[model samples]
Target: MTSHSAPKLAWTYENRLLLILFMTFGFVFFDRLALSFLFPLMSAELHLTNAQLGMVSSALSLTWALSGAATGAWSDARGTRKPLLIAAVLGFSICSALSGLVAGFVSLIAFRALMGIAEGPVLPLSQSLMVESSTPSRRGMNMGLLQGSAAGLLGAMIGPPVVIGMATAYGWREAFYVSCIPGLLIAFCIWRWVREVPPGGVRHAQAEGAATQAAGGTTVSRWALLKERNILLCVLISCCFLTWFVVIISFAPVFLVENRHLSPSGMGVVMTCLGAAWVLWGFAVPAISDRIGRKPTMIAFALIAAVCPIVLIHGDSVWALGTLVFVTYTGLGCFTLFMATIPAETVRPRAIAGALGLIMGAGELMGGFVAPTVAGFAADKYGLQFAMWMSAVGAILACVLSFALVETAPAVLRRRALACAAARLDTQNVGGR
Candidate 1:
């Protein structure tokens, strides 16, 4: 009997890469957000205050911002992704496991900050890789999928229950320990499956060629690249969006339980709606934007998100609150659009990671680090419900900023350019006739 080799499946390298990165990003969110679910328990055990909790969370963001900027530049210069990604996963996983061993606020902050240093590069770097891998037409959709997995599936939906349940049954410490396992597993998968693209390589060459053609062979320096109007707008928009995100994630659970009188389990249920909305809109909005335009989709969603906190303050029932949460997240799909896709499309391919890093760092500094601290202080002094207005204000600002964005959708730009060319041809032909 002749032995035949089995037929290769349809799963391409891109498919495997996406699957691994998806899981990796999911674990990143899962690990980071596990703290949110455990906040009540941790605050109780450690005798911490709201301000202290915000400070601890802010520590992570501060370091993450600094490190992300540095590492993103480093990644761009180095032009290799696999080794850095593997190292990041390992570092974060170890720190996550150690978080379970912390005894006080100081130790907790230290550990989380360390984890942040490791994690800072993951998002921008992974995004850079994914952008290089995807065709231009599908770029928004691909990025949305990655962000959705992190924010919706793993972070919001599954993370709360699993982490909270573990904290309830075993201990919050055990939950931390368990969360690290996935990171380690994913690190191995990345090492085995992912390939690196170096600087001045095929993707970089293509991007340079495109840039040369577009600019009539004039090359822009990296410094000049940073001065572009779109880059500045992207940074501001990111800050606004992140302010909304950090406030909601940091204090919403407490507000639900204490202000609205929902139980922990009930808060989890409401939070699940956040995940579902993120998944639904994260995929749908970006996909739609591919057809329509990023600016309109962003403006519409941001307006919808801006109203959620106002309605939520008045919402008395779980259904009402959940629906509002869903609406809020639908707007947040623009987060992926603004931070990853827009900045990527705006810059030369070689500068993608660095530009993303700058955008992420700026957002994290203002939104992630400062916003939560201010909100926590407000919650302590005024009320948790009042603190939610901060997010509402940020959302409104983001909606306004959406209008300033240059339409960067490749398909849309191509269609418009073609239409203009066709119209010019028609005019010339009529004049000849």
Candidate 2:
């Protein structure tokens, strides 16, 4: 009998997990953005003031920030991501569906806040899982797809067009109703397939929890994370970047529709352009960072990001506007770099979830909660265009702050270390001779 070696399957656990998380995080954004897309249509009928709309926008952000911080630490300590992951996906989807039933501002924000509670930990937890599964070389790309492109593609690219079409035909409420279905299905998939991974990748879930417990990932305090310079810089960047992103997405659709005098369809077209840009630049930036270094990638992309809102405000034709939107919307790619990549590289594996949660929470608190409310008041008092300017300022601030971020990409650091080692070897050999 001849013994034959079996060919290996190319589709590994890493690929499978990435695909699942890509969908899971993507749907989270899709449901979150549904309200923003439907706002222009519902604002008048629901009698929402600009400030109220801003608050409504911030509502989910507030709760999400708090929930994410708590749950991220909880997951790290417990070393159980699947149950919390399943619960968040299921809870948020149901809450998003309930938004369709709200007739007034109070109920709308209430539902949004509840949705935030459920959606808060999805990103950090998903990232923790991905980091565990990903090869060192592919960490930036994998996490970028998970954090940036997934949201951009589903929430921004596909979401605006679909929501607008539904709102146009069936009315805005129906769009919300339909958005809930995807998250529910994603939750079931996660429950069935997703499992915990040990810090060093040697142990399975059964052993991981105990190993993780001994390593002290569970007992680390949130305040202690602030001791690291990279974490501090990331948190600050999150504040400014979130201000730019949240304020624009929250107000730009309305700005395009009312301030630019765009028809709903025209607004949808422009929004879709932004989404497409988001999808392209989102993953590309982080992948580039993997090679070039995270700091330069952020500085360059944020410079372009600062220009996006300006072009939207100034460009007259849809062709001109759409082209600029795609070109300047490069900041989404930087999100994963600072939010998850930088933190993951800086902190110990056990505390990664906590670090991710803190960065997100701080950003949400300021950028998500505070910025939108202020911009809304500015919109009402000055004009909607003011909101766009605010977005630009946020990007500019992030660009300046990027100067301070320590280089953390593994490939970059590895190459530098190799060069130093080679130089040391040459000097030692020469001295001996």
Candidate 3:
């Protein structure tokens, strides 16, 4: 089996899929982060504590991790992308609308968990779809676009101000109700535009055959995938990355309001910097990896991220803190790299989605689920500043783990292959002479 590259097609199904999935994920982020922005209002009304708030946030992540682990494998076995995505979008949209009707802590947690179950599969499955649709050269950038740039910008940057304004005018509950409308529309669009591609389909059969030969003509077992060093490391590094991520998004607003003496509107303005930074780095860094290599790019980002908490803790002024937040989140753009691009490039195509699920699931379970709960507890017992250090430590550990990663960028792999072939050909010619 010979490996062949897909031609880069502009303004076709590929671009269209990217655009829709990009918007789909943007709505997903909007719905999820809306809860964070509204937490202060909800807490005041419901008499919730810091620990209870953390538990509410963790509830979604708990179900998300559990569902993602199963759904990734299920999608792989089912060999369809569109139906899963459609179901996920509709399920979460309805749940998001229903979130407004919750009466107390139990109901709020339960609804969020249900939303988690619906939304969990969207990340890995959409990533798998994007990879299949794109040319090899564009895989990293497309994944970034879907997971980071557009989604991050819409969800984090625009979502904060928009949701905050809506809450102020209507109510926090109504904001949740309003957020679901876009998701419902995106679900309909996906059902219409998105096509399913099976594993041995006409377009990808050659790529699959080549991958099989590369694996010594054997099918990959789930157990075998778990054993790969890169796969294991990706899961670990993602946990660290998510630790930094979940803590900030879940509690940063609270910290700003309570400890830093910033108003709700001011906090919204500062948090928008995070989204802006994410948009910039998310689009630029992964595309840069297409040329430089994944390992080096990740290492650089992780190192910068490790310092974010320290800078953020010391900055007293709003503009200074906002600038630091931007820098910190700029490093966070590598979320796509750890979660999808690296795992996909390392594994066979058939195993890509499942591998992504493992990476996402494990990270969410530890970093997303547990980290925030612990941070909230720490903030309650120790102080908010102490809680921020937890994220800094996680970022440092992520930087350490990144050093162990294997480079799997397509361009780098191809360059090495070409060099090897050239070396062998030169030896053969010299012997003949």
Candidate 4:
């Protein structure tokens, strides 16, 4: 029998960019999850409490929120994807490696915080990098494949088995060290391959302004972007999305292992199934929704997510929960679509990266920072069920918000482009002698 390859250009610039994004995101998840795996080891060694553990989890988000927007702005002003990509990868990996060496909780938090700072810019910058490279028509498909397939599904699947095996054999610290190595290699790949998008070109407002002024038309300030309505909605959506995402991802595995009494290998298998389903849906659903409309897609997914809690809480066996998780993630895949497509539609071309950074950073703060600690605390006190239940509230809110979201398609962009052109021509005629 002969072997056949998958589509070749599914392995094109779009695919490569998606792969890089996935690797960066996967490393971050692996790094963050290390703390959870290490907690048993670190806590016994240092005599840490639940409260202390919460703080350590919180530390990642605290640093991320503090630096996220600034990093986005820097990317916007500089338009240098490779530098941002390289710095985030190196910083996070180094800090994550150093975390294994920490002797106390305070030092651990500090190192994890540093890791947060390093990793904070990667998500927004990755989105920005993709938006710049792809057209609006394909943006949903591209982002869905990159984030949903590479980062979301692939990372979740790969991280567990690797983390579990390494932690079991060599101890958790060794796992952290092991996980950091892949990122270092990825940093090299990003530096070598990810092209630098030069600053001040066709995408910049100032560049457009200069061209418009030379043609006797008024120039728009980048600052004017702050006044847009959809921008505000994007921020709100990000906050809700992050809150829900964190509520689930941070604690679900812990629930499956501790409360459900599954072995680590069993837990890994279930998660791998769930993760594969999610990545597959992430690739598939967004492509379908792109043809239908983002609004309808979001609403449908949000509603599906709303049902996931019921199945998880009521399920009688591990197979039930595992099956439900897979179904739930199909809906969860909508998140990547929303995150990617909304900004490309809502924000001005020049300000997209910076705007996306602000939204993503804020979302991460809510989702990654606050949600995890709260979920951890709740899981400790009221049981994991409460934490899982709270996710229902978030899914409902996301569904409601989806109903209110703007529909951005090619037609919308064409109309807006035509209007801008007409307004420019009108202004130019008035200024002509």
Give the alpha carbon lDDT tens digit for every residue of 1-433 in model 4: 1123222332365557767776777677667666764565466788876556766777787788667777877766655567877988998889988987888878988998998899888877887777766655777887777667765454676666777778888987777776678889989989877755422214454464466668986422335544665566666666777766666665566666667777767777776766677677777777877777778788888777766656666766777777877787665467665666676777666566677667777777776678777877877788888767877777777788778777786655567689999999999999995
What would the TM-scores of all predictions be?
0.92, 0.94, 0.91, 0.83
Clashing pairs in 2: none
How well is each residue in 1-433 modelled by candidate 2, as lDDT tens digits?
1122111211266788888999999999999888888998999899988888899879889999999999999887777788999999999999989999998999999999999999999998999999888878888999999988899899999999999999899999888898889998999899887767522345333355566567754466777899899999999999999999999999988888888888888888888888898888878999999999999999999999999999989999877888889899998998999899999999877788989999999999999999999999989999999999999999999999999999998888899999999999999999999
TM-score (C-alpha, index-matched) for candidate 4: 0.83
Return the clash pairs for model 3, or none: none
| Candidate 3 accuracy as TM-score | 0.91
Using TM-score, rank the candidates from best to worst.
2, 1, 3, 4
- Which regions of candidate 4 are displaced past 4 Å? 1-12, 37-51, 198-206, 209-226, 411-433
Candidate 1, residue 403: how far the Cα is off, in Å? 0.9
- By TM-score, the better pick of 2 and 4 is 2
Task: Report the error of model 2 at residue 429, Å.
Answer: 4.8
Q: How many clashes in each candidate?
A: 0, 0, 0, 0
Report the lDDT tens digits of candidate 3 across residue range 14-52: 789899999988888888888888988888888877877
Clashing pairs in 4: none
Question: Any idea how many clashes model 2 has?
Answer: 0
Q: Regarding TM-score, does 3 or 4 come out ahead?
A: 3
Return the top candidate by TM-score: 2
